[model samples]
Target: MTETDTLRERVAVELTRARERTLTLADAVDDHDLVRQHSPLMSPLVWDVAHVGNQEELWLVRDVGRREPVRADIDTMYDAFQHPRADRPALPLLDPTEARAYIRTVRDKALDVLGAEPLAGRRLTTDGFVFGLIVQHEQQHDETMLATHQLRTGPAVLDAPPPPAPDVPVDDRAEVVVPAGAFTMGTSVEPWALDNERPGHTVDLPAYAIDAVPVTNRRYAEFVADGGYDEPRWWTADGWAHRREAGLTMPMHWHGDGTATRFGRRTDLPPDEPVLHVCWYEAAAFAAWAGRRLPTEAEWEKAARWDPATGRSRRYPWGDDDPTARHANLGQRHLRPARVGAYPLGVSPLGVHQLVGDVWEWTATEFTGYPGFTVFPYREYSEVFFDRGYRVLRGGSFGTDPVACRGTFRNWDWPVRRQIFAGFRTARDVA
Candidate 1:
């Protein structure tokens, strides 16, 4: 097939895959739950479902295809910036049944546009970037919905087999030494790289050692037992304030015992699985208690992507190839993180393991644009979030889709927010 035809097919598959995930999550819950706000941090499940379709229609059917607006009256209702997530349920949202139909209609029109619209010419059309943006956006919302499921208090609704055990026994306490050097930090040539990750830049750093795997539940429990939370010295002023206000003694969903809740069911926390639901403040405090610091954003990327032998950065920890089941736990394949060294094949050249998927690892760096950043299509996507209010989290979680997560992919949130599946690994300066 011609490159155009190939691109169109790929886009179609991605759109389908994303929609399937969105629907599956929506179906898992009843209408009452779908329209219900499970957590203040997340929008109602139905709102997320319809919002993805609205975005698809706005970007693809309206902007790219030059078609009349589909459901323009509800545009304000679905406009994320217009209405905060807390107020979405109060709006006249399309019910679950209507939402499914709306997305189906929008996807049909979007696919039609894909078949006819030339894949090249304008910057947005070039490399089918807009379609990619939509796919990523939908996948991100699906993850958000999954987080809502985790937060909802009720009988278990979602289920998935545990992640595969480690291929080879791994030393959970081991660290990988990344030597001081310069490496390309962002993607300029990657066809669908988002604007925030654009304009590849070089970052230099001194030698440091990062955890070989994420800090596991076992290690974190040690911190908790040692009064890591009670001790104010480990926490920064802001973190200490938030910790006290939020009463964050342990990871979210965790109980006083060694068990934690997952998908509305309480189970023994896996000793080796990376700790989840940790906010930036908790991660920073854990690092301080451990006598190590969270890896800077550059440090995380370099450890995950930079290949010292080749003097180049790879698209993922393993290589430029897309992820498969053997790579890392992603795409909601497993609802929770894998054991620390589960994906031996997914390890980076420097032996850093599970960097791409498992948990969104909190970094020491604040969210900001790279050198020579430029807004594309719209500024709301990334630029609006560029202020220093957010902290950067590298690596995508098990809930992340391959389309949305990459070595350079950036995820950020308020430092005090802990509802999402976030975790951390520690790093230290060379002695």
Candidate 2:
């Protein structure tokens, strides 16, 4: 294929992949489940299904395609900012069958837009950036829908094969010591990179050591055994208060027994699996108890991407190649985090394994924009969340799709949020 043909085909493939994945999640439930809001935190699944189509039409058909709105009447209903998620279930949303048809119609028009734009020109078509953005956006909502699945009541509606049992045992003492250096952080030329990761800047980080693998179930269980929750010395006053009020003695979805609950059900906690569904506050407390600290966002990035020998960074911990099952547990291929140290092939330049997939690894930094950050397409997508209250979470979870995750891609949430798929590793500054 020619370069132009290659780009066009690439965009088509990504768009198809994204739509298919969205449909997979949307189809898993019956019509009743689709229209019902599973949680106050999430929009109804039907809303997400139609909203995905509406967003594509707004961007591709109206903005890029220069065509009329697909359904102007439903615009306000789908406008996320205009109507909060809690109120969406009450809105006059398209029913499941109608939503299905509506989304497909918009998609057909979006495909037409894709054909007209060679995707090499400037603006939204530049490098097929808008299509890339839409794919990522849909994938993100799918992840959110996955979160809603977790919060919903009843038997597990979604199921996936479990990742392979741990073949590679992690050395508890394994910590990669990164030498102090200035590393290029974030991306500048990555075509689909969001504005938050733009304008690559140099971050001078001091020598520090980060764990080779994420904190394991057995490790976090030990913290719970040590009264990590009851002890105030180990927690910030706010975290301590929150933990007590919420009565969180262990990681969310974890029980006093060996059971580790996930997605509306409970299962035995594999002692070796990377701990999942932990909040930032809980992670920080555990780090305090361990006499270590969570890695700063810069430190985490450096550990995951910096190559001191080359004085540069790689696109992913395992390098520029796109992710695969052997590389990491991504794209909802597995329902749970693989055992820590399992994906040796996904290790970083300094040998940090599981940096890109599994539970999102929390960092010490707040979610803020990089230098020269500019809002694109819409401000609500990212800018609204870049506040002091939200902490940054690096890496992606098993539920995260390739379209929604990259080394530079950033995810954030309130520190108290535990219903989300998140985990963390500890770091210690070199003395």
Candidate 3:
């Protein structure tokens, strides 16, 4: 096959994989739940369902293909920046049946464009970046919809077998020291890397120790038991206020009796599973209580991608390869994070485990563009969100699809957001 044929095949496969996931999550819930706003922090599931199609219609069908509008009337209704989540349920949204049909039509047209359009000549068409963007966008919504399921109060509508046990015995409390050095950070040539992740740059840093695996329920529970939340000394001024205001004493789904809610069912918290649904403040407080700190974005990336032996950075912790089931617990294959010691092969050269998936590890860095960052496609995608109010969360969560998760891939949210599938590992500077 020619290079163009190969590229088209890869893009087609990814787009299909992402769409399948989107439909599965949307179909899992009944129409009532799909339309219901599970939390103010999230859009109605039905809205997300329709929005992904609208995005594909706009970017792929209309923009890239130069085709006429599919559903121009409802475009404003689905504009995320135009309407907040809290106001969406009250809007005239497409019913479940209509939403599904709408996406089907959009996808049909999009695939036609995929087959006919030349994969070059236009900036968006170059290397199938627009298709990649749409795939990642849809997968991101799938993850968001999964989070909505976690927030919804009802019988579980989703189920998956638990993630496999550790391939090899793992020490739950181990830490790996990333020696002081400079390493290339971010992506210079990753085809689908967003504007914010562009322009790879060298970042020099001092030695620091990072947790080999994410912080687990067992360890975080110690923080709760020792009054970590009550101690202001362990929290920033803003974090202390938010903690008290929100009554956050433990992880979002956790109950005092060592149980946590998962997909609407109450189950005993698996002690070894990486803690999930934590805000940046909670992660920071826990780190302080444990006499460590959250790793900076640079520190976290270096630990995950910098290979001391080669003096180079890799696309992922394991290497420059797409993730598979054996590498990390990604793509919603399992609804929750795997055990702390799982995915021995996913470990980085520096010994950091589960850096690409499980939970988004909160970092000390604020959301900002890297050095020489340039906006491409659009500014709203990432450039507009460079405000300091948002904290950076490196690593992907179990719900994240591999197409959307890479070492340079970055996710960010307000520090007070606990609805996201987030957790953290602590780090300490070497003396």
Candidate 4:
């Protein structure tokens, strides 16, 4: 197929997938829940629904088409940065029906712009980047809405089939050595890569050995059982303060005796599931308890991208291809992480599993600009949070859609955050 045809097909697939997922997530609950603020941290579902379309219209139609906004009056109502999530419910947001109609109307115009548009010769559309960006933006909001669903206290409003059972038991001792060298640490050519992930640079990382898979609940439980929470040495000053203030004994949504714990309203899971909902502090403390440190961002990316045989970087841990169901547990296809070591097909060249999905893996790096980072479209998307005591998270979560999850896609949250889908694997200097 022609390259432009390929781009058009991709645009169509991504747009449809993003919209459908958003609709499905919003439809899972009743109309009242859709417009209600389930949690103070998240915008109302109805707000997210309309904001998704508003963003698409702003970028795809207005920016690409060079046309004035069709609904300029409602722009402020949907501007996320203008209103905190807690106060968004007070705005005059469109109802679910109106939201659906608004998104459909915007989408109809966007599809028309997609065909007549050239693939390049512009800043944002340098290889249809804006289209990809819009798709990613819509999918990211869908993920946020999914978080709201999880926080909503009710019987399960969403359901999905469990991931395929692992063919082998997980080995907690599995760590792979990524050889010492200068490896490409970020994306240079990924058309849809965000501004923070741009301008790939060579990182001279010393040799390190990292966990082949993420740290699992079975292992984290051992730390908790050993007075890991009560002890202060393993935690930082800030972490210890937050720990005591919040009275956190275990990962959020967890409750049990030392023998077993359950997540939210789910059934009791086996010990092999990757630990989730733990903040950076908890993950770091657990790593310290195990006599390991969390991988630096450079080390994590090297393990995920380097191919020792060819001495080149792959777009993803497995290869330079778009993800598929056979490769990773992503796109809300499953509501929870698969058992560790399940998606062997998604393994990196160095044999790292669960690097792309199942959960967002925390890294021991602060959120900051790259060497040549410059504002694009606006600064609110990533730059504002660069200094708000946020740390980096790699990989995507099961709640993340494929359009939003890429090898270089970066997620950040405060170290004290626990409601989000976050997890981690540990690394150590090569001995």
TM-score against truth, every candidate = 0.99, 0.97, 0.98, 0.96
Question: What tens digits encode model 4's per-residue C-alpha lDDT throughout 1-431?
Answer: 98988988888998998988999988888889999998888898999999989998899889898777878888998988889998998888899999989999999989989988987889888678888888889888888888888788767777788988788876966999888889777777887888899778888888899999899888988988899999999998888998999898998767655332222365664688898889999998998888999998888888888999998888888898889998898998888889988888899988888899898999999999888787776799888988778999999998888778887788898898877888899999996
* Model 3 weakest 10-residue run by lDDT: 164-173
The positional error of residue 291 in candidate 3, measured at the CA in angstroms, is 0.9
How does residue 113 of candidate 4 score in lDDT? 91
Model 2 segments more than 4 A misplaced = none
Whose lDDT is greatest here? Answer: 1
What lDDT does each candidate get? 0.93, 0.87, 0.92, 0.86
Candidate 3, residue 146: CA error in Å? 0.3
lDDT, residue 316, model 2: 89
Write out the backbone clash pairs for model 1: none
Q: What's model 3's TM-score?
A: 0.98
Estimate the TM-score for candidate 1: 0.99
RMSD of every prediction: 0.8, 1.4, 1.0, 1.7
> Model 3 over residues 1-431: C-alpha lDDT tens digits?
98888998999999889989888988887888888888988899999999999999999999988899989999999999999888999899999999999999999999999999889998788899999999999999999999988999978889998898986766768999889989999988999998888899999999899998899989998999999988999999999999999988888988889888999889888888999999999999999999999999999999999999999999999999889999999988898899877898888998889998999999999999998988998989998899758999999999999999999999999999988999999999997
Instruction: State the local distance difference test value for candidate 4.
Output: 0.86
Q: After the best TM-score superposition of candidate 2, give how far the Cα of residue 391 lies from its true spot, in angstroms.
A: 0.6
